[model samples]
Target: MDQKIPYDDYQLPVVFLPSYESPPAWIPPQERIQHPDYNNELTQFLPRTVVLKKPPGAQLGFNIRGGKASQLGIFISKVVPDSDAHRAGLQEGDQVLSVNEVDFQDIEHSRAVEILKSAREILMRVRFFPYNYQRQKERTVH
Candidate 1:
């Protein structure tokens, strides 16, 4: 009706099909796993690097609520006055989102702990992206 009822306005379109070739079953499939370390800020970190005294019956955890409620995760927690993390540019309340270019959000906490504890003197790829605690919040103070 919007086109003034014109019969020449359109036509049925033609379709084309391509040939298919199947791969041999012997060929191994490529890996589908993501990097397993791509950290997303809204997620809780496994705290894989620390050997801290956890609460009774508690496991290693990142302080997800230790900062401004809106920017809750922007701050790193309890970096030692002069520890490896402190030396490695980790500051108290510095939002942590990565270790060696891998995000904490990409893997399970157990796997992350193993990766962090495998070696005491390893360099990790780290990224610092603003994270929202919940999907509803996105405004950043910085």
Candidate 2:
């Protein structure tokens, strides 16, 4: 036992080990099912402003679903191919942060839709965290 004690003293303590890496980047709760990048190099979750000019009686060509009315967030459920929204880079799983310079975070879903429908020129600021394409398709199916 005496001889073994000398060897034990040479071992490094746990604290001497390399520091723990930070926890994997957090993906928002709504985007959990969709795999978000651990490190967003280019975008970094910044809000992007997209401007769309739709002629009278034209659709914006995107579908949106509102989050809790009190919370103020909405999901872009779909973007029609070759539509104005499509050309504008609107993607499924993008979160709509505001419309027309007005924050929609706390607005009711129907009210937000109404605002969108009523506007001829739309200015939208959105956060896009691209999820897995396959997973997004699955969510749409069922």
Candidate 3:
């Protein structure tokens, strides 16, 4: 149990800064946002496509690998000593491109992973984005 004592007076600061009479005219205009080519470069792998760096213990594991980010490929998180993944030519750094001849980005996370596990053998394609020659040339000149 605790005894209560009440004898307090409080006052907050009410200072006000001088208001701007007029804004300056030199502000630069904002740029228009560009849309991403999700269908081309960003092929969704799976909901669990994000492989944690290490095994999840009692505490929650997984980080914002650039959060909500659609990555280019599937990065291998772990290599089980004796597992089907390891047995089926899946390496630690393998990138999954397509499953059953269909791109993953076309499907949502839940559907993609379910299709993968249930089917036992996923017909995944591995594709890579060609280097951007224009961007490379610009960087070289700069």
Superposed on all Cα atoms, the candidates' RMSDs to the truth, in angstroms, are 15.2, 12.6, 17.5
List, residue by residue over 80-119, the lDDT tens digit for candidate 1.
Answer: 5555465555444444444555565444444455544544
RMSD of 3: 17.5
Answer with 1 or 2, whichever has the higher TM-score: 2
Cα lDDT of model 3 by residue, 88-113, tens digit: 44444344445666565344444554
Per-prediction TM-score, please? 0.32, 0.60, 0.34
Residue 31 lDDT, candidate 2, scale 0-100: 73
Please give the distance, in angstroms, between residue 48's alpha carbon in candidate 1 and its true position after superposition: 18
lDDT of 2 by residue, 7-113 (tens): 45776652346768998776787776555553436574678999999888898899876545424357787899999899989998787888998777766678888
For candidate 1, the per-residue lDDT at 40 reads 38
Residue 116 deviation, candidate 1, in Å?
0.7
Clashing residue pairs in candidate 2 are 72-105, 72-106
Most accurate candidate by lDDT: 2
lDDT of 1 at 76: 44
Q: Provide the overall lDDT of each model, using Cα atoms, as 2-decimal numbers.
A: 0.41, 0.74, 0.37
What is candidate 3's local distance difference test score? 0.37
- Give me candidate 1's TM-score against the actual structure: 0.32
TM-score winner between 2 and 3, please give it. Answer: 2
lDDT of 2 at 36: 51
